[model samples]
Target: MTEHSEHGTQFVSKKYTSWPAMTEDINGGTLHAAFILAPLAMVMAREGDVPVKIVHLGHRDGTAIVVRKDSPYESFADLRGTEMAIPHRYANQRILIEKLKEDFGFGDDEITLIDFNPPEMPAALEAGQFESYIVGEPFAAKAEVDGFGRVLYFTKDIWPKFISCVLIVTQELIDTDPELVAELVQGISASGKWLDEGDERLMAGVHREGHIPVDPGRGAQVIIPDGFGTSPRMQAAMIASQRQYYNQDPELLKWVLSRPPDRVRYTELALARDEMEEIQRYAERLGFFSRRPVTAEDPFGFDDYCDPSFAESGRRPLPLQPADGQ
Candidate 1:
């Protein structure tokens, strides 16, 4: 129930379970900055659905689609009409589904969607509740280790190097206290850098001691490098795909598109308006926005969201000593 303040010396928060739950917490004024799916955060920030903006990329290139080990499916086309599990409609997994439909003619009705939190996906797949699932790391790696599932697609292969999670905060925080936001961003960036370290044994040992009891090798398999930045390409990829996922409502798009860009603030990065615009144009060519939400206001124009003072002043993560006596 604690909220961050401009003058507070510490940042404390109650843990949330899922993306939707985390979104709700931030919207309900419980949390300040959160590690969230990039697309969902942008979608929520659009049209002021939530008073938040993305500040930094938390992690990148860590999602995969997993199919049961014994299943005969070899590609997206082969999995038509099968049951699949996803973390949520707002997750990057939905973009993969859309890509399948675009490339291989898979119908929305062809594959059944089963909703499960990422943590529960492995057990559900092993129990035969679904034939396949798409989720972020650890869960996918767990399935591989437990011998119940095999990776079929890594989303990076489909999109040109996209981001998965991002750090977000309320617009009020950015408006009021820029220093606090910078500190938070630096902390998250350093953590991601630490996670991206080459020392697998240390990371694996920490993983083993922390939550899951898996071996170092298994832990290494799930760990992926998370590049931190405010790359316009990353923003465009997330926004364009999200717009397509929620293409059912033209009015919603219109409302979102007409809204002025929020003043986004960052530490070391600035908004890449041109790259995002180019991405939007390309996405339009690919039929991402068949409805054409707003012709005037560009959703990718995040100048309002661009305040990189914090990012510029903050420090990145440095290498740490080896763990587990490595």
Candidate 2:
């Protein structure tokens, strides 16, 4: 009953509480497509013998490092010798922590890194089990909303354009139904654009309501009742989608919305060789690629494991501009 047919194609969505379980399903061919940690996906394809390829990205700059608000840790340097938790060893959050250690000139034994489920991190930190934890949002926002954690750094601020997850499909699916894969990529690309643009418009409306000031850098214009002025259909569709996909706790949603426009971005999701190379380099440096040695010339078999054509050719949905005279 998880499968629903749309436009003659059956779509199934599966949720997993842990990356290892999801990765197992992905490797076993139970899941055709998923959004997973970028480094983990690369390791899965190259080291774990899964025939999957990265087609598009999930989002950018959505991860953060959080410490208890009452903790004495004012900076990353203060966390030296303290235990820190990460969702997974293969996660980019782990790589970011390694980078932080390098940047702060800390040794390997300086900070103890533990693997803990992201959802349990906030509670553990509150109980003094760890000094800090880094993971993707909604979780970080959860901590802030509960008034227990304060952000030490948003990945966006430190890594700039940090990619946590990517959309990957099995190679079998790609070879058997290339058109379906193309449709999937294009649909995701368009939706990502739509979400980014709609967020801008929504933020503008929030600004007009005196809730928050619109950032001039984002070029958001003041709009009326619906973020898209005079476009009731667009407004209705956005509302419905939010109700379905983003139906999280009200306080969590509010905390997410109160963040700056660029806290997380959905645009620029197309897979780029340079970005992939960067992740591979970090993964190699961090010893995530244990199955085989990676060389500077070609790491992780990038060309064989990635197909950017789908994302490059994907059509973007046009934003609904405000109509003249209201």
Candidate 3:
């Protein structure tokens, strides 16, 4: 989704479905800003080649740990020496997993860590490849709805007000057009407001009516996984096609609708400076900055990476405008 500022500034936004593509776009100058995972951004920044700074947070507290619905495991304590998968070492999921281990008095060897792409996680779990997988939704939600897994814990339950994704910009963009960056943040914040309202379906995209393929054998009980990673503009049509997947079972619908919204101010999008500091400490603890170690005391001259001044002007409300051709 995109929004225009009253200054007659037009913003065009695009979605990159994968991390590599998103990071490539940011580093290659194809896009000026992005909603990216926080730790990964920190890693890129410390590596010194991808000069991007996190200006605002995109989301928070929307991660979970999932296990097969029929599994005997009950908690982190029950999964001793079991196979576990996380998206990557740089992901917040790994930190939480470590915290889980420490809290439960489990040794590092008690959990066999495996890295799996988010989409592959469900299938891997279903096939018993791993006992549990931790990732961000709608993947976790996808597993539950498909009846293959159930949530063991939500990161929100463990780490209150946890910060995850963030909005970042290339250093060049920040230097060349700070106002434009502010405008973009304002636009995204407004979009978040619309999304937070929760019934407008603006976040869900355009729907078109027609017959969509569903398995005849499953009858009306077929669960189509069409819109899992769909862009907002396409989610309407994608969701429309997958109605049975969402509506066939009231309990599942309740669960899907029950996923909590990320905690965001909506009107003023700014980096959670305190949380970012915590992330920096965790990254260092996890050895992400081993080459150029960033500690709490000597955070390696990284304090300048966070600049909240843009947010000062960026938080201003956008003047409502008519939709195109209205």
lDDT (10s digit) by residue, model 2, range 1-326: 01111133434445678898998887777787988999988887787656888999988997889999988888899998999999899998998899999999999999999999988888998999989999897788778889998899988899999999999888989889987787778766765666665433332222222334334333223323324332222332233224334445544644553476567777899898898988888988888877777777745567866888887665634333333212
Candidate achieving the largest TM-score: 2
Clashing pairs in model 3, backbone N/Cα/C closer than 3 A: 81-110
Could you tell me the lDDT of residue 319 within candidate 1? 27
lDDT of 2: 0.73
Candidate 3 — worst ten consecutive residues by lDDT sum? 215-224
The model with the greater TM-score, 2 or 3, is 2
Q: Mind giving the per-residue lDDT tens digits that candidate 1 earns over 100-137? A: 77788766588887778987899989999989998876
Candidate 2 stretches with Cα past 4 Å from truth are: 1-10, 199-247, 295-299, 316-326
The TM-score between candidate 2 and the true structure equals 0.80
| Per-residue C-alpha lDDT of model 3 across residues 1-326, encoded as one tens digit per residue | 33223244555446544788777777777777777778888877777466888877765566788999998988889999899999877887888888789999998798988878887888889998889999876668778888888989887688866666778788898889988888777666665555444232322123223223232221122122433432221232243234432222333333443454342223334676677777777787889877777657755434556666676674545343223311
How displaced is residue 322 in candidate 1, in Å? 11
Once model 1 is optimally superposed onto the true structure by TM-score, how far is the C-alpha of residue 143 displaced, in angstroms?
Answer: 1.2
Best by lDDT: 2
What TM-score does each of the candidates earn? 0.64, 0.80, 0.75
Please list the residue runs of candidate 3 whose C-alpha ends up more than 4 Å from where it truly belongs after superposition.
3-13, 197-257, 260-269, 295-298, 316-326
